[model samples]
Target: MSRIYRHPTQPTVELPPVDLLTLLFDSEHSLAQDDTILHQEAANPSNTVNKRQLRDLVERIAHGLRTNYGIGAQGPNKDVVTVISYGQMLVSAAFFGVIAAGGVYSAASPSSTVAEPARQVKIGNSRLLICGKEHQAVTTRAAEECGLPLSSVLLLESSPEWKLRSLEGGIDVVSSSRLSWQTITDRQALKDSLITILWSSGTTGLPKGVMLSHENLVAETYITALSGRQWAAKEIEKGNELPAVQYRTLGHLPISHIAGLFGYLLAPMYSGGSVVWMRKYNWEDMLKCLKQYEITAFYTVPSIFLRISKSPEVTDHFKHLVGASTGAAPMDGKLQMAANAKLGSGQDAMIGQTWGLSETTGAITMMPKGESDTTGSISPILPSVELRMVDDDFNDVESGQEGELLVRSPLVTNGYYNNPQATKDAFHDGWFCTGDIGSLRDGKFYIVDRKKELLKYKGLQVAPAEIENVLFTHPQIKEAAVVGVPAPDDPGTDWPRAYVVPVGPDAVSEDDVKAWVADRLAPYKQLRGGVMFVDGELPKNAIGKFLRRELRDRAKREMGIKAKL
Candidate 1:
């Protein structure tokens, strides 16, 4: 039997039973009680980011959205602002700006293409698109393609490209009203709906927009703040209490990811803590920041941990770093042990694991601090979250049996934006199907495998089909199958491994193929894991569909690759 937790809201904290709703606010009474704790964080004197500043920023933005653009509460002022905040206060201000103006704020990964910005705008049915001027042209083109008038596009920063003279005198579309981002960040709440369109990583297929309301965001953030006190309590009880200590974190994950946006950004700030920024991932830079800032907590994916383990300087700076949390992708048990041992117990640093998706704002389950051997397990379900295991037929699965993970909670997204068919297929009754296969053991959750073939590189999802399709565009490639190979840097995360069958003898060099794909895809989606050649057609099951399991096994046999999982 799974462990039954003692918390008031979370009693039956069994596998698939504990969801965000059950963990955070299962009842009105629990919410009322927890609200006190949340308010305490809000009122903490040590808060690095003040609520008044936040409030002023929001009110200012609301006023700007209304006055500068003539967008009133009931007017047709539904513009969507897309941005990537690298753990900066700007993200919070932008979020508030959207809510204050009754507009939707869509998140875009900084790595996303200049052409894809329209996904969020079109999904939200937005009239205007706002972005930094460097990003404005791409946003403008994408919005234009989506049928959004270019007149509705607003650039936060001005560029020579934005000047109408660059495009042969007069511009075809009326320019959107210009206002300082500084000015727009001051308006207070206008009771406009709060919506943020989060794109799924598309491990399953094309990304869909997960719609979250203001109430959903506030509820999740408040609960996360309330529950975060448990961290301090766990730390002190583990015998590392200090009178003058402060909480700080290194935030490198994209603001577009739920784990980075909600868990690392909003939750920490809401708890009177501060976050350090790294625009992108760089192992040496991360170590330097840890040593320089004496960063207490770090949030990241498993691939980074692997790089750190391989680094010789990791041990020296490991002592200064406090708690570390890894999520978004699975980490190998051996790598987890290595990371844990690097940060000795005396330093009060705990290597924790958090499980989450785009739907739940981030973190459905957080490993208890000081616990040992959380290698493959995702710990217990969080305070108010709920989970369930369902068989292939949708019936409940028994404990210790692998099955699809279904989640139901107030924190789960209301549904996919404007896609009722997707919404219907994604949920059974009310449970959101995670499409991940896993099992429970001793009250903890462990992912056995994915029911679908999606690759995770340091927690970012990469669809094999997408890469294969991209590869097929090459003239020499006749057949292609992409599979994830356990990375040597870290056994925890998977690397995109491609197997290619060429049309002619020695038709393409590996470098040639890699260069071709690199030109078209982002850095993370590159075929850096190496490409292998095959003489015959790819092994397939009885059906015509490629059997990824067979490809993985055959690759392991042929390449002598072994997994630490």
Candidate 2:
């Protein structure tokens, strides 16, 4: 049973067409009719695309899926195996196929820590496990540990030994047979069934996978295209018949991350746009690709922009880009201003930023381009999204007052994978708890902080647990507790601090440790608060939870003592 929450104020925006796939195809068709093919295909789009051919391509994928994956089939009562659980490539394919089949593909972040697997599994309500070869071991280990059987697991990796075996069997047989993504059909997803499993940031405890249907992703993508009107204006100004937005996106964000998967891959490709991918982060290579591809739109974290602004080569090469969209992390106003200056005068890129979570499909509030002081202002709620700010008593706050942001949207996940208690807590009455502290002023959303004790620097959100996980990755570190300490009189709200128990005398120094983290994480999450070597264990709560509050208070006391001395 699905619950619908009517907003205190009804949505005033025009409802977008429900058939998003049709719109994308039509839009492409319109582009073709007007001879507005992107720069690459300006000469001859006969090699590029035609609407009927594109639709046929989709049909082919659907046909392949039905034949290969046993879609719309009646089997011998044996639980059929589909690999939508693991192998990011399969997950991505599943997402598209599901959309094509009118099913939703759940959004699951691959970077979730080990402690979060069971919670994600339960929240997702997904029984079938789909994964590629590289992630099979980890996925299998977690699924089995969570009591999911071997029959439920589906392997999509290509191994020479198992080339001839069929994929419709138990886990062992499938593993032995080695199924490649190429073998799977592209359009076999069940439309009405749950397609996606979006999860919360999972900064505090376990991550809950939110269930999303095919309709949800399509709906959101359609609205996103409509909401960004300034980009449309740019295209009109350029004398193009339709908006000249190309689908060239930088695909550096993890496939599991919503921004990476949907925003960069699905949305653009659905619009007949192509994306440039990076297996790993290479700043220079990215700039080179942008210039080489003449990427018109840029989607990434603010930290990425900051890095590019600092890199002379990026500015030199990517000056032709007309629009840029930043999300996944908050962009500093100073940085935003700097970026605009670096890009120079000839091309005024429509720089925009947005705020969202995995549970909301992708974006809820976006600061559209041409808006001033747009750094932290996570613009108006989308047509489908409703926002409410409540105080201690759960009463709505006055216009200027601050409160916890409760969001309700069709884009909201069905619930946490399997954790009913967590789900109940997350979805109260009708609104889903964003767990983010924010304030709405004149319809603009400004995030204050997170309900959980996670630290965010720049645009890259830093989960304290992820940092702790990284700490344990070190050979000499025994126990570690990472916490956010509020930066005093600083522009950004918080800075991350880590307390670690060392196993030996010659452990890495604070600078060495910070440098180590810098190499892994984006620039904003650098451990600038300085590492402290603790003698024993960190202070804990009754249930063995690290009392981060105590650490925060201790830091304050130390600062006060230093001032007194």
Best by TM-score: 1
Name the weakest run of 10 consecutive residues (lDDT summed) in model 2.
176-185
Alpha-carbon TM-score of each model against the true structure? 0.66, 0.64
The lDDT of model 2 is 0.55
- TM-score, candidate 1, is 0.66
